[model samples]
Target: MSHQRRRGQAAIVYPTKVYTDSRGSRVETADMDNPIPVTAVFVPQRSSRAEVAGQQDIDVTRMIVSADVQGIDSWSRVFWNGSMWDVVVPPAYHHGTRHTRHYTMDIRRRPS
Candidate 1:
C-alpha cells in the first residue's frame, strides 16, 4: 500500500488500487468508509521544545518527538482529542538566571 499525499494536510495511508475487468471501466474509491483527516505533527524545535509546538496542533497522538534544549531543560507534549490539540503541559519553567531550573511537563493521555 502506498501513501496518498495532499497539500497542506496529512498523507493518508491508502491500499493499492484495484483494477477490475468489467467492460474496461475503471473506478477509484477509498478502501476505508469514513475517512477522518490525519496529520503529521512537525515540531521545528528540538524534542524538548516540540512540546511547545505540539500544543498548537489539532491532534496530539501523532506528534513529532525530539529533544529541544541542550541538556533536557525544556520540552513540549501535545494532547489530541480526535478533533482538537491542546498543550497538556506548557514549556518547563526555567529560571532566567538561576543555575538550577524547575522543569515540569504534565503531558499524559486523557483517560481514553
Candidate 2:
C-alpha cells in the first residue's frame, strides 16, 4: 500500500538531547532543531493508569512513517493531537515487496 493512503495525520518529530544537569541528573530536552514534519499512521496500542504518584494516564501508540522520513530515533519526541510522546524504541525498518519501505516504532506519552 502506498504510504499516502495509510497516512492519517500530520506529526512533528522533535529531535532531543540528553545531558547531565549541574545536579548530575540526566535530562531530555526536545526541539534540538526545527521540528520535522511528516505524515504518519498512528495506531493506539494500549493505555493504562500511571503507577507513579501524581502522574497522569499513560498512553502508548504505534507510529508508522514513510522510509523517506529521516533523523528520527529512540531519543526523538513526537507531537501529535496536542500531546508530546516519547519514542520508546528505536525505529524498526521494514522492507516490503514492490519497493514499499517504512519504519515502525512505539511511542509513549507520560505525565509531565
Candidate 3:
C-alpha cells in the first residue's frame, strides 16, 4: 500500500446474479451477503444542486484505492460513510511508481 492516508474501509457491492425471465429478459439482484472490502481514501470533489422536475442535491466524490482492489466497475456501487454511492465512471488506473500505483474513480450520490 502507498503512504496515502486512508479514510476508512469501503464496501463495494456487485450484483449477485442475473436471472433470465421466461420472456428472455435479464434481471439483476443485489448481493447483500457479500461485499468486497477495501481500504480507500474518500475526497469530496464537488456538490451541486441539480434542477430537473424537482431540485436535488448531488454530491460527487473521488475514491482512491490500491491497484490490487479488483472486481469494481461502473456497474458497482460503493457503501461508505453510512450512505451508498453510485459509481459514475469506470475506474481509472494510475500506474505511478511501484508503491504509488492505485485506482481512482468518481462516485455520485443524491441526497434524499
Per-residue accuracy of model 2 over 74-112 as CA lDDT, tens digit each = 778998888889999889999986446888999998566
Best by lDDT: 2
Candidate 3 lDDT over residue span 1-112, tens digit each: 6655354566555524457989999966545566877778888899987778677788999988888866677767778878888888889999988778999999898365
lDDT of 1 by residue, 1-112 (tens): 0121112244222222345657887754333433233333333232222256435323233232122222221122232344223234443554533323333333333332
Clashes of 1: 13
Clashing pairs in 3: none
Instruction: Compute the lDDT for candidate 1.
Output: 0.32
Identify the superior model by lDDT, candidate 1 or candidate 2: 2
Worst 10 residues of 2 by lDDT: 1-10
Kindly report which residue stretches of model 1 are placed more than 4 angstroms away from their true locations once superposed. Answer: 1-87, 96-98, 110-112
Error of 2 at 62 (Å): 0.1
For all candidates in order, the CA lDDT equals 0.32, 0.82, 0.75
